[model samples]
Target: MPPRPRARTYDPAKTRAAVTAQLEHVRDAVRGLGEEQLAAPTRLGDWTVRELVAHLSMAVGAVGRHLERPAPPAPEVTATGWVAATAALGGDIDDDTRSLAASAAPAELLDRAAARFAELLPQAPGDRLLAARVGAMRLDDFLVTRCVELVVHTDDLAAALGTTLPYDRQALATATRLLADALAAKAPGGSVEVRVPPYAVVQCVEGPRHTRGTPPNVVETAPLTWIRLATGRLDWSEAVEEADVTASGERADLAPHLPLLA
Candidate 1:
């Protein structure tokens, strides 16, 4: 596997709006859920709906706080690398999320956090590089990560309530591209082409070179399914059984390199 690549170019204006729009989508869905629904269990291990909401709020809040400090002299990690490296901070993150969840009602907590985030957003410049503990990353890059957080957690919320929520296209696109890029970084090779149609397609894994038309090895899935696979929400065999994923060619089986984050 090769090191993660620098972030793909993002339109700061579009990305900012994408983050807010995606959050509003989640918030709207969250508001319609009853109290009992909020107490249900999410697919994230033992995390309940309430804890998931609190964590989403934390993802948005981190940006505001990082913008409060000075940018680092240089980034320690690339944008795609951030996804895989997140588990490194898992312990403290879980503790903080649980603490936040315990301190207040989910609705009220997310409301206040959203309000705080909105107030600080306009004051932040797109070029500003936030001094995040994971690494120093641009404000726009941070917003892209928020899209992943919003999309993934929203899925958790829906799974908990036995319902499905509509995903904002731009949010889904951003999340798909980021994760796709991460996979290419983790398993660097051009022998296989992994496609998430209409969103992203990345070549990865080491094997025979295919420089011409019709690559020999390929894996394909929709954006949501790809996200679930990357995050460990769904297993390789389960996806195959459900027909959510389609793999072909000898090098296409990726079960050996999965659940990038524990």
Candidate 2:
């Protein structure tokens, strides 16, 4: 894995709106799930639909939970650093998700989470530090990570249900950019240019830096494809083979450093 990269800032107001909007998208869809549908298996290991939805609530509800407590002394990580640190917490996340899943109906869980998040967002200062699961981050930075959480799992839930869910434009864009920045941080260099059209384009993978017209190595894909690739839901070679990802030059093979935050 690569070290954390330079920090990126997000618009605090837009982040708050994006988080709420994306959660609304999820809550609306989860409200219609039957008992059997809640039990459906998802691609995330053994996490069923119920557990996945529970995780979403937990991810958002964390804001109020954090705000209720004393603010941390200082931010320990940025949004990108939070991304780099998430892989090690999988076991704890699973345990907590299962516990939360058993505590309430999916819709209710989301309602309370969404409600509390909305309530707290108005009073909290953007620079206030929350002791997040991985470490402390500003309220705004933490919410940016929440966008990643909501957008990524929205796709997961959609896949399990054999349908598509809408993405809040800002949420999807934030998630795509954060994950793309994480990839660049993990594989630091300018040898390859990764393009997720209309959202992000980052130079990464250590080698000769491109300074002129067209770079030798370039990888291009849709925003969702890039997100799935960064999070390990989509395989690099598989994407290339399926015509979902276009890679040029030898350095474009990113499988070795993939699943950056999964």
lDDT tens digits, residue span 134-239, model 1: 8887777788888888888888778888888888888899888988888888888788999999999888888876789999998999999999988888899999
Model 2, poorest ten-residue lDDT window? 1-10
Displacement of residue 262 (Cα, Å) in model 2 is 1.2
Query: Which residue pairs show backbone clashes in model 1?
Result: none
For residues 139-258, write the lDDT of model 2, one tens digit per residue. 888999999999999999999999989999999999999999988888898889999999998889988888899999999999999999989999888999999999999898888989
Which pairs clash in model 2?
Answer: none
Residue 104, candidate 1: C-alpha displacement in angstroms: 1.8
Off by over 4 Å in 2: 1-6
Q: TM per model? A: 0.94, 0.97
lDDT, candidate 1, equals 0.83
